[model samples]
Target: MTTLQGSAVFSACAQHRHRLDRWWSDEPRALVCAANPSRTDALRPDPTMCRLAALVRHRPGLGGFVLVNVEDRIATDPADLRRWLETADPAAVEVARRDNLARIRALAATAPLRIVAWGTLVPPGPHRDRVIAALSADGRHDLFAFGLTEAGVPVHPLARGPSRVPLGAPLVLWRAADEPS
Candidate 1:
């Protein structure tokens, strides 16, 4: 497959577009949506959701169902999630997952779907196999995760790294290599 590289803004827009096709009503695919806390500004999800929703609103798709969850925090309230789902095309939220099996079972009812388990960590543990098995049983769910590098840099497989750190102009513009003594 071909890969495209661009600025962060471009990448975000591309991600939004890809997710739109996956979760929009016209295509009617089931989704397990989550975001990395660092990568996504949860407070401003409209731009993100709207991009996904617009696909459904504009396209003649089949489903607009999504089981939304947040990374590392299972206590996120469904009611409080309304702001996250605020868009022209709203998605149906599923219960938070304390166990992976339960989520897979919940999603079985909605098959031929795309499952997106974004921004969660399932390290080598007792429950890891069970979660993998649960995901394997369903052909539709596309599970994803996000985490930080050893150096504390936030990373996503889909994104390039090491992530850029914000630097002020005076420092950023300094170029010792180009300086002539």
Candidate 2:
């Protein structure tokens, strides 16, 4: 296999919450869907993205991944993120989500599927549901996960090191948690 290098990108939001997109490596496989953005940007990888890069580097056939989040809100704490998602400006949510699907599809490129890596960090509710529903419809790609969390969501790479989340483990089909839609 040939080694490829990709450029890192950074974008700032007016609200300082939602991020449009960022690139970690040049040869992104498809997408690594996470709960939300941390402090990760063009400069450095947060714990989760760091773990993900490690996992992907060792995983055969998997190259690199572009990080997208269910909730665009940026927070270091998952609890605060959940609260923010529940109460973010409805208008902003619509605007942020407006181009998310297009962004995901564009990032997908020719990949047949996308990996769900948000794990249990993302709370189950309308915000998550809305994104899942939007993507699952009309030309949605298949969803795969390294494994399930104790809560049955995708296993977050940051949940454990690459040792626990082995590269040899095959990706499995994952669906969103059931909540009132």
lDDT of candidates 1 onward, in order: 0.33, 0.60
lDDT of candidate 1 over 34-97, digit per residue (tens):
4422223322343334433332233234355343333222223433333444432322222223
Error of 1 at 133 (Å): 2.1
What is the lDDT, from 0 to 100, of the residue 53 in candidate 2? 64
Candidate 2: tens digits of C-alpha lDDT, residues 1-181: 4443343433465233333333334443656677767766655656676666666665545556667777665677888875865798878767766666556555555553467787776667765666665444433555668788666678887666532577557777775333223
Measured over all alpha carbons after superposition, the RMSD of each candidate to the real structure, in angstroms, is 16.6, 4.5
Candidate 1: which stretches are off by over 4 Å? 1-23, 33-62, 68-100, 116-120, 138-158, 162-181
Question: How well does candidate 1 score on lDDT at residue 96?
Answer: 26
Worst 10 residues of 2 by lDDT: 14-23
What is residue 175's positional error in candidate 1, in angstroms? 46
